[model samples]
Structure formats: structure tokens, C-alpha cells
Target chain A: MTDSIGFGHHQHACTTNNCTTPLAENIREQVQNHPCYSEQAHHYFARMHVAVAPACNIQCHYCNRKYDCANESRPGVVSELLTPDQAVKKVLVVSSEIPQMSVVGIAGPSDPLANPEKTFATFKELAEKAPDLKLCLSTNGLNLPQYVDQIAQYNINHVTITINCVDPVIGAKIYPWIFWQNRRIKGIKAAEILIEQQQKGLEMLLERQILVKVNSVMIPGINDQHLAEVSKIVKAKGAFLHNIMPLLAKPEHGTFYGLTGQRSPTDSELSALQDSCEGEMKMMRHCRQCRADAVGMLGEDRNQDFTLEKIESATVDYQAAMQKRITVQAQITAQMTEKKEQQPHYVQFIPLTSIKRGLTKQKFVHRPILMAVATKGDNLVNEHFGHAKEFLIYEASHTGVRFLRHVKTDLYCHGDDSCGEGETALQRTIHALTGCEVILCARIGYGPWEALVAAGIQPNNDHPYEPIEEAVEKVYKEMIIAGKLDEPLQQQLGA
Target chain B: MSFTINELCTNCWACEPLCPNQAIYEAKPHFLIDSRRCNECEGDYPDPQCASICPIEGAILDSSGQMLNPPGSLTGIPPEKMSMNKI
Candidate 1:
């Protein structure tokens, strides 16, 4: 298993609470590095927003997620709605409150382009305002064709479309109707318009080099059995990422976004789908189901600043806004105040940046005595270097010589493919898992290099040419010169 | 709780290292316990260990009644145990 096909990297994705390893992991990794977000990025970093696109040219029963709109929304969840301008203002106000806000996206809240002017304006304003932020837009293909150029023009990185079925008969069950070229088409025709648009949109965006992440919401009673075909077709057409989101049956977010809100697929089912697509296409199992015009990482919400009533007050007036907002927010204020009377003052503020930074610790240290076995078998390992802290022995097809005469430390090495750096992946995983000081390897890749640095693994790749014995001798000599090798090896070598 | 571990476990020990909880152990028949430590990274990131790196099928079972772990993770049931039972 080479870096392209190995399952070592995605293991990190599968460990947390309710996560799924993408079915097609190899393809998933390839797709995730689409210039916007890498596979390594945590979903906690991305935020979601349901756009107020109220105008999807096509309709998928599963496409009913919304922003926190004061207007009617999902049943239990509280949502506040804002226009494009308001969305930006809210974003600027909230980002300072949350640090992991890196990417901004407009998902279904409604089809972004269905409300073309607003979506584009939001994108434009966000780009101009937050130049460092990446932009993502999800849509129904009915409007995708028209916006591909614009998507590319703005250098928007991620574009997800809900494509449930390629077969019109099956597609009809998931989608109710579509508005195409000014006409409302329903049944198979609507399905065809959407599928055609989906295929066309996917093709065009790919041709233009925009990253397309296709989301296929798996419904047990709907298109669950035949979803792999969707993966194959999209992969063939170059859709970079495929996310088969679990169908949430919440009473809110439309009928499908959480419709039945019945139990979604099991981890096994999700893993099966991911496995099916493993070799063929990249799969996105780490979706946050973000809100439209969401600013930040996937599955994260940053608008903790304003509430439904307070939002309108936050509208252009920061000073007068509070006074205006307070009048409108007064009623909810009483409800909150009443609750506060019954509850303690409790708040949960996440220090995400600090934790993420803590996860990545990097420092550089120098060691003169280095040891590596050159012969076959347990060769690449042994006690040799003067400043040996630990000894690692990796199982190699060709073992190295047993250098018994040398300085000692601890023993280490792994024959397991994922245990040691596999020429491309080990440096990173080791750095993340073991906290290695400096990984000495034959070759390295960007993924491993970054992973190591992120884990604070100082890697020294280019080692001087010397036999294992010679290298150990050099270590002792260097240590003696530095006045630290007062050990037995140094004494035996008569340094 | 939509998952399970199938009979495809080979005991190569590839997955034991990947699991966050050290959930897989080298017991009698090459053991693996849920301990529910595998929450699918929901409150955390996403996905459980058995589904991520297991090379063998049926090793890590998901809610769909399928083996999520792939082929290589199914290192085998072990020769010592198999031979001892026969003897």
C-alpha cells in the first residue's frame, strides 16, 4: 500500500465521536486537498450556513436545511435570518469572537444561485472584506451551469451539489420538481433537468478546474441501495469529493435535511459506502451540514454574538443598533431573564485555536551522534549514536547488521507498514502520535513533512554518508568535542 | 451504535495501533472490544477506528450490518490457537 492507497492517514478521521472513514479513502484524500481544505483540517474549523436562496430551480426532498432565520425554520433549533449584507456584518462581528473561522460558504439555506444576486453579493463582499477566507457554495445543478464561470472567476474552491440518483425513476422519488429556464418542470422531466444540469454543471466546473464536492444524502427508503453508481459517475467526470450525508429526520431544515429525523445510516453502512468508493473517488464523510453563507470550518457555527431579535438591531448601527435591538429584543430578553433566574450563569466558550496549536508543537534540536543500521534485517536499528535517547528497530524486508559495539539508549523500530514512515506517511503520523524529536528518513512528501511539523516533529532528512559503525564513531567524537560523551562508549573509544 | 466487528479479523494488529482507545487487544482469539470508546468522533471529529484502517472485511462492523474494516486488517485468527483447538 503506497501513500496513494494506504489507509494510515484517514485513521485520524475515524477516531472521534460519531465519525466515518470515507468509503473511498484513497480518492477521498486526493479530493480533500482541493486548494481549499486539506484532509488534515478538522471539521470543527469549517462553519455552515443555509442560504436564503428560497429559489432553487430544482428541489430535493433532502435539501431542506436553513440558516437561523427568525422566519419559520426547523422546529426545535433557534435560527436567525439575515440578508446578504447583514450576513457579512454578522460574520465580521462574530469571527472576532471565534478563532477557527477560516472558510466561508453558502450551502442550501436555499440554492445559492437560486437567489443569484444575494449569493454572489455575499461571496463578493466576503471576498473583498475577508480576503483571507476561502469561499464555498453548494447548489442544485439547475442553476449550476450558469454560475460555473463565476464560481471559477471568484476562485471559489468547494462546490457541493445534492445528486441522489442517475436513474430518472429513482431520482423522481427524491426530487419533487424544478424550475428550469422559466418553467416549472415536475416528475421525470424535472428530474431530468436536475440530472442533466447536475452532470453538465459537474463537467463544466471540473473542466474549468473548480473543486466540486457532490453530496448524496442517503435515504433508506429512497436511493440508498444504488448510491455507488453515483460515486462512479461523478468520479469518472472528475467530481473531486463525494459526501453521502446521513438523512437527519429533524422536524426542521425541510422534510429531508432532517425530515423523518429517523435514525440515519449506521457507521457500518457509512463505512461500506466509503469503502465502495475508496479506489474510485474521494469521499467526504466529515461534512458539517453548514448553514448557508457560513463563515468558518465545516460543522461549526460562529454566530454566537447576535440572536434572532438582536440581529435586526445589529443591522448597520453599532451604537443605535443596541438601543434599537434592545427594544425588539426586549421580549426574548424577559424570557432569557426568567430562565436566568432559574439557572446559574453558565457559558461554554471554546479556545479552539489554542487547542489546535497545542496539538501542533514544533521545535528544533541538534544531536551530533546519529545511528542507522546499513545491513539487511534489524539493520537500520542498533545502539550506535553517542546521544542516543531511544533505540527504534523497524522490521524491514532486508535487515541491517547487528552493531553491538556502540553507545546505548532505548530500542525502537517497527516492521508494520504504518508503524514507521512509509517513505511518505510515517514522518507525519509518527510526529503526531509518538512526538518524535527528529525523524530521519530516506525520503519525504509534503503530507508527511507538514504532518511532522504540525506535530512538532523536527525531521532531518539528509544524513551524511557513512557506514553504521562509522556513524556511531562520529557521534562519539562529536559528543566528546562537545564535552557530553563522558559515557562508557566514549571511554572505550578512548576519546 | 450502528456498527459491529465481523469474523474477518486476522490479528495482524494493524488496526490496534490506529484505535484511539487501544480498544483492540491480543486476547485468546485476537480480541477487539467496543468499550464504546469508539464514538465515531461525533462530538470530536468523525469516524471510528475499526472503519478507518482495518484492511479486512467484517472486522469492524457498522450499523448497516456490514464489515467496515478492509482486508489487510484481517491478519488472521492465528495458527497457535487454531492448532491448539484441533489437538
Candidate 2:
């Protein structure tokens, strides 16, 4: 059955040259095209989530499941819920339309395991119908132990378990109750049972050689500091990646934390936590905290384009679509190869003035710097500075330009009339770009250019329409040449 | 009169901080503008801040159910042409 579904063939199909760190060949192959698992792969591949499972056993303080929510883009929110048959149809339509779509994930409006029958039914249908697409699931782990066998039997290779805390005391604060063993369990006891099941399920999946990624919500006051311990434990237990996501506690979400004024972590705070946990495990920083019905590429959401109504009326030629998808993917791979070859080769440039001053003994070390690029996709820095809703952040060093994550920011310019009045918005944009030393955009007006420069962020319009990675590297090299790499960033901005 | 964010808003966080009156607040389906506090940037700016920066064509609306940044205003692409291209 697994062989018929085209499983295990991906074990040797690693094509992208983005993997800098060495990994087992099979492990590399599993994450090669998975957008959520690999940071670099997100640029070239796409994934869609089917909101098939609408039932959850665990009650998390930060989660309030909402259905038919089209406007908001967040976890546990979906514009439409689909039955197993409807889900299969949607996947076929989406895969046909989006050639880069590779993985189909059943991450809830609720937990997938809690709705086992529906979740497995969808997976079973997709495995049989669309044998080429990879299958994955995100679960709360309350019912994970019971479904591990079925998961492996269905060739579900990737599983993400949201494990916030290993200790039941800390877990109690996050999880108010968990429906287990035909009873509604509450408080620390409920947390204990949930924790035990999560550990056991993680171990069971690892034993079966299935890849597991652990996700933890970084609730500021609750279990914020304890996540490092959770990361250490999961890594020791063979979990491949640890994604420490910020708690989305907006008051309007109606979640317990949201109502009680539990604030979410700042971008800097989340980055700091991820950095601290980086030593213990491979930290995933590129997560978009997508909605259950999210579609298309990682940062861009194309859900409105493939609604159920659209798919129900559309017909799919699976064979032709699959062939076309292959051709498009090959083109993308070729483009990536060309871009890789075009990367600026790193060269150590010691300033002649420093050499004359006999400061040659001081090693001219080039530290990695973060740069934010304004782009409207197509892998180019083409978006205007004022028009960017989100900036794709990249870390450039002597090695190469690595995609870090996208930071959503308030727009700085409204229009010609509201030119100099975007002070509050400009301040927020600058604050969101806390650690970034440079901003690369297609064009910039005078007001924002002055504000950005005053905040110590060099706003450059030199790399218009240039490839993102190449532009970032060029900016890094320019900074190196100007001897500005060693100077400490201006502290006046309070970044 | 106050401005409103209709169903077309993608919750991109563009208009939330740009509101000078701090009238916009995050809601379940989308961001909402407080009618009482929303002066439509009358004294603050020449135009409503939220409508000017919104990327989506018909996302932000005026009190009378008219789009502030209507079709072809931001992208200069006609709505008729956009719909014809949709699959």
C-alpha cells in the first residue's frame, strides 16, 4: 500500500542545494520540499492545510477555534470546513492550480487526532487519489498515542506535536482541561495525562522512524522560560525541529489568555527565545502560524482563490496537472541553481588604513548581519518601502545569505496626502525591524527615508528588482568595504 | 463619519498602527474601526490613513458603504480584467 502511494521514493530525491548542515540522506530528502519543515525550501515550494478535523480533546488557553473566518489569518481559524470527500476535491484542485504545492497537512480548526475518523479518512482518500503528494498532521498529542499506528500505516511521514511544557504544573496554566478516557479531566491531572501521552506518542513515532517536529507556544508569563527545557527534552528524544511560536493573545480572539490580557511576545523577545533554544535543538523560525485553511506559499495566503465553491465547480485533469507540476518544479529548481551560482563569493577585505596603523594583528572578523527586504514575491526586491506589508528578513554573512523569517509591519506611507503624518506607523515599522541593520526596497519617499536613517537603519533603493539573496550579499559586502561592519549599531533607536 | 474594514481585509496589520486616533482594533474576522473615536483623520491628515495604505482594492470602506481605496486606485489594474484572469 505504501509503495503504491509513492512513499519512500522521496528518500533519495534531494535536489535543492540549500542544506548547509549535514544530515542523514533520508532526513534531508523528507524536508527537501516541505515548506514548513525547511526554511530554505519555503522559498521554492508551497503547502496547503485542509480543515478536515474540527474536534479537539485538549482545551488550550491560547486557542479559540473559529469557523467560516475569511478575514483573519491565524491558527485555529478557517474560512470553511470540509468533509473528507470535499477535502480530497479541494486538494486536487489546489494541486492542479498551484504546481509548487507539495504537502497536504490536516492541521485543525482543532486537533487532527481528536477527529481521527475524519482525519484518517481524508488522508486515506488523498493517499489513494493523489499518490504523489506528501501527507502530514499536526496534533495536540492527547490522542496521538492511540493513532500512531494508523498514522504510520497511512504513510504519514511528518507529525508535529504542540508540546508547550514537560512539567504538569506549568502545563496546567496553558491547558485548562483535556477530555480523556471518556471524562473531562481538568487542572494539573489533565496536564499530567496530556504530557505523558505526548512523550509516549513522540517516542512511539520515533521508534517507527517517523519524523516529528515539536511546536511550543511561547506564552510570556506562563511557560516562557521553561521552553528551553522542553526543547532539550524533545531533541534528546529525537524530534527533528523545535518551533517556538509566539502566543497570539489578541483580545478579540476570545481565547482565555486574550481575554485576561496575557500579552504576546515582541519580535525581539521571540527571536531571543529561539536563539537561546538554538543550542539545544534546531529552532524553526519561519513559521507563519497559518490558519487551518491556509493555502499557497509560506508567507502568501491564496485561500480565497480555491474556496469550496470554486473547487466544486472546477474539473481537474490529474495526469496532465501532475505532468505540468513536474515541469514547473523543474523550472523552479533550475532557477534556484542559477541563483546559487550567482551568489557573491565572500572575500576578506582588510582596510589599508588599518594595515598602515599596524592593526593587522587584530583579526578582521565579519559577523552575520540581518537585512530586511521589501518584496512582492518572485524572489525579487521589488516592493516599495512604504507599500510593504511585510519584510522578508535575511541574515547575510561570509558564508551566504540565509532566509530568516518575514516580519509583518504597519505600512509607513498611506498616499500623497498622508505623506508626513505616518509618524506612529513609521515608529512601529522601525520597531518591528529591531535588529535589522539595513532595509532594501525598490523605491522610497523622502519622509520614510529620513525616519529610517535617523533610526540607524540604512534604507537603500539601489537594488531594485534584484534577486533577494544577491542584493543582501551586495549590501553586506558594501558595509564591509566602508569599514562600518565593526562600528556598533546606533543605540538612539532603542532597538 | 467613521471608516470600516470590510470582509475583504486580510488582517495584514497595515492599518492597525497607522490610525492616528487609535480607533482601529483587532477583531475575530477582521480589524474594526471604532465609530466614536474614528474621526476619519479629519484634523490629523488629508485622508484616512487606513484606506491610503491598504493593499487590497476594496478592503477599507467609508461610512456609506463605499470603498475608500476602490478598484484601480492602488494597483491601477481594472476589476474587470482581474476577474477575467481568475480561474
Candidate 3:
């Protein structure tokens, strides 16, 4: 899958017609690190998909209810389906363990939009907690219009819509039926509705400046020849990339097309189709047909290493406790914000007592997760990590940020006074913040940033001179989204 | 006319999805509200959703150069009374 087509240079529709809109640099940065979107980043960054969605609105000829959808080439396969709560916990574990995990997707055993509640719930949780990681959604686009606004609200930056064919004739041949509006419609009618909704959804997303990728499953003697046309339609509507996947036609899979003796396209045939489609749009040829619960880098599935049982056991009680705190914290923060003009002094912490504990012995003792802010007397995150010698540790929580302690650290780089011993200071600085999950600095060098991440701390260099509470609020909110305080460690079981 | 997000605007992403006209976009250093698309939520809502939800004071300014959400908008704490530091 050589991305010689250069998606980075291919801006969305706004770039055309001398558009009034300015190019979004931060949004480009958001996509720049996504492995699926950036060919270069694919070597370094990894992604994970949570199979929370378990229902489909439409059935395709190449799809088997028993297997995952035709969006990816994988046959009937999926890991354990998890509730939204369990999914967030699993994400936190995977994120902490695999630092390269940059995107969390809902490419499912079922349509994400079909189970909107479960899908959106997982997304909302991730949006607040793991805001740094990108959110990717792969939908059949049947219900895309209904959920576009909500999807935008959740800040889903990337979306993948599976449009096998733009032509209803070919679409009718591919899809057996679609359950739309209130009832199921079969044959060409279903294909028409699906196509109409998909195009509408694509336009809406483009209007919102959201990045879109179109995934088309090429079935030999079915829609394979029509894929080049599908690519053009989607590309014109501002789709960022087009992934033409090969049909995995096997009788054992029980797909309608497979049962009808539909032959799979040869590798050369699939590549030839992709090569032709490349001229129409940016073609993605490196797709590995990842499973619903696929994890790690593309072409690699490390889901077996992280199981549902292990995730549930590792994260259950910790998340239950944190969720309660976040709810209360949100209220307190709101009240505090309301009273800001009237009260000049900092507000005191209100002790919460509403968390009802179950008899199940808590296995892990909650570590006082700390976030270090680089400040210079104004209570702002205003200092560069390289220049700072002191850091303020805050007890980060959903309830609120509490001042824990201040630590003096070695400077990461040399000041005007002396040439610094860079590596020694870097190690010392990392060691000084051993217990911290995040270090908020105005600016940081790449060297120390990498070291901090390697030391299990996420270095946040975004907010410069922002209010400490605002930074703390952002961290605490992400803490809620992450659903876990820190990486899971061995602890005594509650007796 | 639509509002423009200046340098003071943080890329908090709080206002991007809130726009009814789907005008907000991410740019380096800050977000930019598309002038052509921004109707300021005239018919959709009584006030602009972007300015209403923005956390930063004076981050978004209207076409006429008036602050829709002026200082003391979010927290009600006056900007003058707040401590100022040069980052």
C-alpha cells in the first residue's frame, strides 16, 4: 500500500475554487499522525478498534451476519463485545501499555450507527478522557445523516463510509436489503436510499470540515468494475482517501455472494482496480482487513495480548470510583466558575460522600495520580520544561485539581549561565516526575518530550500561559475519558 | 456576517462542533471561523453558539469588530483584575 499519491498535499474541498476558508493546520496535524491517513506515520503510530457496535441496519451480499462487515477483508471474526464503560477501561489499558496507540475506532462486527447509543457513548467517553487520541468511525452510511451533527459534537475528526458502488444497479446487486426509516426495504430501492443518504452525509461532513475516507469492497463480477466511478463521486464530495478492499469470498463464511459462487479478485486484479481508482482519488492499497477489535499498527493485530476479562478485572472498580468523582467534579467546577467574579480567592475542595461501594473487594489501591504544571508565580502553565527547575504537582481528579506538592528538578537544557549536561539533566528531570501521569509545560524540546513519554508520562506542551485550573480541568476531564488514573499495577486484593 | 477567531483563541475544539453553519476549522496556533459560511447562527439560534461556548475572553470577534463574548464572559472574572504573564 504505497501512499505515493500524497494525501498530505490533497487538502479537502475548501482548497478548490479559491475558497474563503483558511486551511486548518491543527486539523492537518490531527490527521498527520493517524496511521491510516499518513503513510509515514503508519510505521510509528498504532490504532485500536473497540467492537461496541453490535447491530447492522443493512445487509450486503458479501456480508454474513456471522462475520464482520465487508468494510475490511477479514471473515467472520470479532473479539468480545464490551459495554461503553468496559470499552473505556480497555482503551485506557491499551493506551498506557502501547504509547503508539493514537487512534480508537469503531470498525465493527456490526454497523456503528446501528447501535448508536453504545457507539456514541464510547465516543463521548473517549472524547473527554483520551482527547489526544483520534476518533475514527467506519459506518455503512445508512444512518449517517441522522448522526452527523452528533458525530461532529463528539469531535470525531475522521470517518470512513463503505460505499461499494455509486450506481444503484450495481448497489442493488451488492446489497440484499436495508432497514431504513421504520421498515426494511429490499433490492434496488434499498440501494437508492443508501446511496442518497451516503452522499448527503458526505456533503454534510465536508461542510463541517471533517476528514472522510471512503472504503469500497470490490467484488469480482459484481461492483469491482464500478469502484473507479465510486471513487470519483466520493472524492468530489471531499473524501480524504479511498480504500478499495478485495472481497473474501469463501463458502464457509456463508456470505450471499460467496454462496452464489462469486470468485474473489486476484491480487493483480485488485491492484489494477486500485491503480485505476488512484487517478480518480487517493487510493489506499495497504489495508490489512483488520478485525473489529484489531489493535496495534496496521498489518498487525495485537488484540489477543489484551483480553476483555483482563481489562475488566484490571479497570472495573477504579473506573467506577473515578466516574462518580467526575460527575461531582463537573458540578463543583461549574459552581466555582459561576462564583469567580464574586470571589477573588481560590475555592476550597468539597469532600464527596455519594460513591456507594460494592462488597466486591477492590483489588487495586488508587494511587494519587499527579500532574506537574510548569508555572512561574502567576499560577499559569507558562514555563518550558527545558528551562524550568521547579514543577508544581497537582492531585488530578474528576472532582477537581488539588495542590499536592512542589518538586525542584534539574534543568533539561543549559541556561544563559551555563552549558547544561543535557542527558543527565533529562534523566534527572524524568526521575523527579516519576509518579506523574502528565507534565504541562508552555514549551518543551523534542528530546525531553520523547523521554517523558518513555517514562510513562504524557507531556502536554499545548497550553502556553493558560490558567492552571484550565489546564488541570483539561487533564482531569481526560482522566474521566480515559476511565483510569494511571497504568495498571499489581496490588493486594480487597479482603 | 461571521466572526473570526484570533490568535488568543485556543484550539480547545469546544467551538468547532458547536457551529450551526459548520464554519469553524482547525488552524495552526488557533481555529478559524469561515467568513463566508458564518451566519452567526441568525435564524437557528438567538445568539452565536461559538462565542457563547468559547472559554477564552475576547477570542472570537464579530465582523463589525465587536466582541460577541467579551472579557468576563466565561468566568465573569474581569481580565484587568486577572494576573497577566508574558509567555
**Chain A only TM-scores, each candidate in turn:** 0.54, 0.85, 0.59
Residue A480 C-alpha lDDT in model 3: 42
Any runs in candidate 3 off by more than 4 Å, and if so which? A1-27, A68-76, A315-495, B1-87
DockQ of 1: 0.01
Q: In model 3, how well does chain A match by TM-score? A: 0.59
> In TM-score terms, which candidate is top?
2
Model 1 lDDT, full chain set:
0.49
Chain B TM-score against the true chain B, each candidate: 0.56, 0.90, 0.87
Q: Per-residue alpha-carbon lDDT of model 3 for A1-495, expressed as tens digits?
A: 111221321222222343322224655455655777754345346788898776666767766554433223362257476788888888888776666677899987678887788889999998877776789899999989999998999999899999898888888888766766444466789899999999999999889988999988889888877888888888777787788888876554555555556798865587578656666666665465677888886645678888877886674343544454445434533443353434332222222221213412333233446788886533468888888766766665423455444555632123423323344767877877877889999999888889899999999977888767567656655554354543233542322
Q: What interface Cα RMSD is found for model 1? A: 23.6
Cα interface RMSD of each candidate: 23.6, 20.7, 24.0
Model 2 lDDT tens row, A295-367: 9988778888987789999999988887887788778766755654453232222343443254343445556
Residue A356's lDDT within candidate 3 is 12
For model 1, the stretches where C-alpha displacement exceeds 4 angstroms are A1-8, A11-37, A48-52, A63-78, A250-263, A293-300, A308-495, B1-87
lDDT of the candidates, in the order given:
0.49, 0.77, 0.68
For model 2, what is the error of residue A290's alpha carbon versus the real structure, in angstroms, after optimal superposition?
0.4
Model 1 clash count equals 94
